[model samples]
Target: MKSLISRLCLYASMLSAIFWPQPARAYLGSFEEQDGYRIPLDGQILSTFLAGDAQFYLNNIDANGYTGVVPLGTYPNTLGDGTHGADLSRYNAGEYGTNHSGPGGTAVDITDNSGLWRALAGGRLNEDVNAPYYNGSNFTRDYVHAYRYSGARTGSAVLNLLASETNLSYAYTLDARDLNGTAPSATAANLIQMAFWLCPSDWDDTDTDNILGISLRDAMNQTVFQVGYTGDNMLQYRLTGGAWQTTSNRMGTAGWSELVVILDTVNNTAGIAVSAYDDNTSTLASQTYVLSNQSLGLDADALTGLQWDLRGGSLSNGAASFKNYFDDFNFTVSPVLVPEPSGMLLAGLAVIALLLQRKRH
Candidate 1:
């Protein structure tokens, strides 16, 4: 009997070790895990950025000719292959050694549905290319930057999908690197609200009822699906009935968090997966959150656009500003499968319970 008890204990321990959840390695997708210079030219639009670089894609289509924002300056109507039209000035170009300190220039509040702006950092009045935005390092590498401008702001894009594209999947890596504040270390200064929204084809930028600068409540009332990150570090989503719901786990304070949203219009459901990496680029096991098969608000055939919003938190002046970094954006017609708790882990727990009961007898 003693020997049987010892063998059972060993088996349970080995099973637990094998089935326990582990941290996931960081994934950078098409973009490199490096820093980048601030976008040189002021008010540069995403449409032109797509026309210049082929690296960005929308629903498997090369990111070019998509219309959502106003043109910043003179650009070639016809762009050649490669990064021809996508130089630093056309994109985020600046002098290699110049200290770019400016209160005005390319930085503009996106009020007229002008899409996203490219800058070195956010929540700071000075748009300095050499500003150390992350961990005492200058901003480098290529990623979309989002933050609160004059009011709340959203980096938006329009999706022109094919008729055959029924269901949709969208994904991006988000780096909630740091928060800038006036009081510096005040507790209220720690948080800023951010969210991602999936909108239907009928989403109009010109709607008078639409608060384009900040909230998406009007859009959310439509067929839009939303995933939100609160100041408390919790991940929340919109239910089919139009109310917001939170996941079981909270996210990490800093690092890259990958969010994938799958919209299934045929089944009237949507799903989301949220995972974050530590400063070391390794996944934080405690921050993984997934909500699958949530109900949708309205029955729709297709989704046409998406928006990412950032709102300022706890601020009287320069203090308490937040920045969100996005990269490796993807969209497709195929289905996406989010990771869930393992069945083996549950089985291992059951075995341990049975063994303990026998030992007590």
Candidate 2:
């Protein structure tokens, strides 16, 4: 009798398994996964409910996809004036410079800021790239890392958004150190804050009303959503003209900090998550914060571009200049998840119930 009961339970389990639905297959390619999340490809249909997805992989200096070749020396250093002058001119002309490219393979027509942006190799002193695993776990082959110079007056990488993309998710693997590969003093003056901005595509710089400089910080304060570090090593976020609310996580520790942000334009909300992998203690800390959009500021629909804004008041200590390293910068239209088939679920439950009743008889 006991053996009969065991056989009936096994049959019921098989009935449920046979009726279960399978998940959608992920896009397969080299450098396709990051931090356990699959980076979407251009024109790939992630869901019929939303538009196709797109991704920008910052794996090479030329902005092309990784080609199994390593770049040499610091980028834009061999270019005009060696101070990024030619590239600066291009940026002023609404370009991404000859050396630095924008997020979407082409530059935007607007000048958002005058920050110095370039690319650097991995495993170098003052900048340590996450090799073998870019996010300390999933993904690899990140030979180049994006550098936002702390010495520049302002630093940022901006890109235009897709037409039907109501949601945006970005990931950056970051490691901060002085020129000698040593941990820099965690002083308030040496703090570096990197924030994301969702603003209008026509965001102007040094416009007719302004004379000398355009305050990127002031402009960021006017966007639909802003989320990033607090410069003092805490994660914080805010809506336009709203007070910044802090999360429970601390960033910019000893080793690499993997950060991902998901923005919902339809709801005017954002979710910021980070996983800090410490090199010294070999430990990992993860935290997340979800900010709801209770009040709307500027119409989120008008906000068509994403901007990475960095600010560092004092970046140098003695002879060593503090460098902020960012790698594997990825942006994709957030995919709408498909719900499980309810009819199949009910059928499986019915099969299991019928099997149990037969055993009782």
Candidate 3:
């Protein structure tokens, strides 16, 4: 019996060594992981981005046809072709760099209902644009409406960003409403809301209803985060799971800002970071939110059920309308390895048994 027990102990020790658990490594930026996919935005077709190389997809739905310094392919007349349509050409030419009418010329016609709505509804993963607004009508039946505008008549534009993969991910949208009177609230269902960060720039005090933030329902129309803005000229974050958790680490002076929320799949946690600089800035502020199994509103089995919302209030005294611009939206999934707890426990027991056997011998 002693010999048999000694052999069993030796076998267990070997097995433990083979099945030891290893600590997870830190995940780098959006697409820095070796195993993760990287989709380069070089004005290529959507098919090029979805050729199976990118693990995450970043869609920038621009209605004014101005995609910043980047020159992406133009979707002509609801078709994913390189040709520029009449509606698209109007804005495409009036955009910043392009030369259509003249220098500093504004493209008012492009901002029309047909041009903007067509781009949103026709957007696709790598080849098309998904139109989120209604044509010739401000009201939408199924999707959310996102728009952007400057202080002037022709300074605003609207855009949408879609993830490449079909999985449940977290995202945040900033609606630039004219908070001169009261705060705004809109229903956002079928979205895994993380938090609403608001920066109120120019608005009157009577506009207490100018709510800068609020959380919405999860991807399955479930409530996850709440919305509340900090005092005018400040930034705020609100939690939605249990008790309402709030935080204020204002990052910018209050205008068009970029709020990024990412899921650290490798560490099984999530984090929210904001950057306002047009270029690079080290002063970017970010807050880390640890996610527990129960706290993750969605179940393990149900992935790819998340959605986003970008509509809520009125703009220009509820006359012109509110508009917001978004770009460079990306999401990544980390590779998780199962740990062998049983093997570790058995290894500890074997060491004890081996020591006792040696002593008896």
Candidate 4:
């Protein structure tokens, strides 16, 4: 019986080692990890410091004159082609980076409205290229830039596929700040919400179910984070219906910012890191948020669902919209150190030491 008990103890120790946290790591939108250690999405991507200016395009279409959105087929993320009418290849040139004979450029356009809604999930801000932007105080050169919008606004998401085979993922942007230079003043009238949706466990991979979003809510008089919403940002994320959690000051820089989430399938956790643009002029830094909510967790082993969403709420001034700008959006997955319950392991060791001491006495 003693020998059997010893074997069980040995098994428990092994299990503890396998499940205990290895280290504490926070992955910004540009970084990720898997199975331990640091791992980045290698190869010629759209635009990363590692890409060496090698343009990021899907290289599978001829979308040159296709105006407006078409039915989404399968081009960027699945096993098919994007062609509903007028030879889809013509439209691919602007966004897919393959309009001309070859494929390599700094432009991406997706006007198709079908398939999965995550085709552009891994897009980065102009890759720190010939990027320029208006930094509220002044228009800065050689800085990442984006299009800002504010007002009674509405639009459709044109992506269709955002499945990640590799664990490496990304979500880059120039910045997410008050385009009108509005300060976080009393009774904010404007509200904004931006997020990447992930399908839930029960929903079909093709169904858009879950969402991870950052919202500016006038109702709460602050910005809030979301896990699910009523088809739009105004609803906010809730189980059946309730108030959402809030974050600190929203981003204020117009440099390089991103939202990175490391999906750990085995452990059922996602490490979230959000970095405001890191231009030397901007003092805002990166922050980390842990996503243990069911709606925010990984759908399957792979990121099978992704939806890019942005919406505006009514303002205190009764304004419908406030100008906002964001570019260089990317969302991929790699692996990194994740937090674990190590205190228990240490306590176990202390108990063993006490037992040994008693035996010796």
TM-score of every candidate relative to the true structure: 0.36, 0.35, 0.34, 0.33
Instruction: Please report, as a residue range, the 10-residue window in candidate 4 with the lowest summed lDDT.
Output: 28-37
Worst 10 residues of 1 by lDDT: 158-167
TM-score of 4: 0.33
lDDT of all predictions: 0.31, 0.29, 0.29, 0.26
- Where does model 4 exceed 4 Å of error? 1-95, 98-112, 115-242, 253-257, 277-281, 286-301, 312-315, 320-322, 330-361
The whole-model C-alpha lDDT of candidate 1 against the native structure comes to 0.31
Preferred candidate (lDDT higher): 1 or 2 = 1
Tell me the deviation in Å of residue 192 in model 2: 26
| Candidate 2 Cα errors over 4 Å, as ranges | 1-222, 278-280, 290-298, 312-321, 335-361
- Write model 2 residue lDDT over 23-110, tens digit each, in one string: 1211100111211112222322111211111212224333353311222212223212122111211122222222212222222222
Arrange candidates, best TM-score first: 1, 2, 3, 4
* Worst 10 contiguous positions by lDDT, candidate 2: 25-34
lDDT of 3 by residue, 171-278 (tens): 322121111111112212111122222333333222323223434333344444433333232334444455433444333433345454433222222344454422
Candidate RMSDs in order? 18.4, 20.0, 16.8, 18.2
lDDT of 2: 0.29
How many clashes in each candidate? 17, 1, 44, 43
